[model samples]
Target: MKEILLVLDLDETLLYATTNRLIQKEDFVAGIYYVYVRPDLEYFLSQLAENFKLAIWSSADDVYVEQLVNKIKPSAVNFEFIWGRSRTTKKRMSLTDEYHYVKRLSKVKRKGFLLERTLIIDDTAEKSMLNYGNAIQITEFTGDPHDDELLLLASYLEKLRNVENVRLIDKRYWREQVKSI
Candidate 1:
């Protein structure tokens, strides 16, 4: 697949947590969408589209995803690509958790791409344990209605571009090596 799947956690991750009152001068006071603040977020996402598949596997309910879509829609979006809620019987499992589910999913989705090439952008550190070494965990995104974590997220996202490029090159070289033998 020549596309990268970047699943974002909407609540605290993308949309900053709101307090009792949504003061006009506080959280999101500037009206800047979370996806819009990150420097090159669109470009980074676009780049991911160039090499791997793009889909959203959020643990959030579909309603939230719908609201986000209504707010800032993805460039290359497919309603089917949005998956929410876990369909497992795992006791004590959080309904609002797609970390482990995404790991299991990315493997099947990116089976040809290899798990190591896949990455996860989340604010929760615990979720990082989902795929351990295979996934890249990016946290501490304030979504401060500004470009605070832009550099951080973009840097990690850049690594994925490397992963995808290397994967293609490696595949090409491997095929050549096999043909020569």
Candidate 2:
């Protein structure tokens, strides 16, 4: 099978970590921030591993990113790489005063991945905007125990894996669903 790179985001995307609460094993507390993984996150990762070469590209620093990832995939066998803010470039959004750390697919391409065969799964659209049609913008996971987005995403991605060029799979499938609402 041809390999397709599936780059994932950590915070708010696959999991939600807040500094507002007491820290636990499930939570990664760095200085003052508390990070927590989404429910069924492990099963979600396992399912995706069946169809894609997974990698985590979080905007968080290296230490924090690895810590959070280790909490989930302790053996790190399912992921191909763990990329942090070091691989990202910062950009200030024109629409807002806040700056966004953009994770460009070009970086993944530089790592030898065919751009057409790669997809970025991030909750924040702004983070994956550069990739356009090659992204799956998910709703931010706020630690909801009943969240089923990943489960549905795994099904969608598995189906997408059969296609020669995943980029041709219009991201509008999710957008259409949103429009009907």
**Which candidate's lDDT is highest?**
2
lDDT of each: 0.46, 0.79
**Model 2 agreement with the true structure over 7-44: per-residue lDDT tens digits:** 99999888887767633454556567666677777887
Predicted structure with the largest TM-score when compared to the true one: 2
Against the true structure, candidate 2 has what lDDT?
0.79
Q: After superposition, how far is residue 135 of candidate 1 from its true place, in Å?
A: 2.7
TM-score of each: 0.57, 0.87
After TM-score superposition, the amount by which residue 32's alpha carbon in candidate 1 deviates from its true location, in angstroms, is 18
Candidate 2 stretches with Cα past 4 Å from truth are 22-31, 74-76, 175-181
RMSD of each: 9.4, 3.2
Candidate 2 local Cα displacement, residue 60, angstroms: 1.0
lDDT tens string, model 1, 118-149? 55555554543444444444445444445435
Q: What is candidate 2's TM-score against the reference?
A: 0.87
Q: What's the distance in Å from true for residue 60, model 1?
A: 1.7
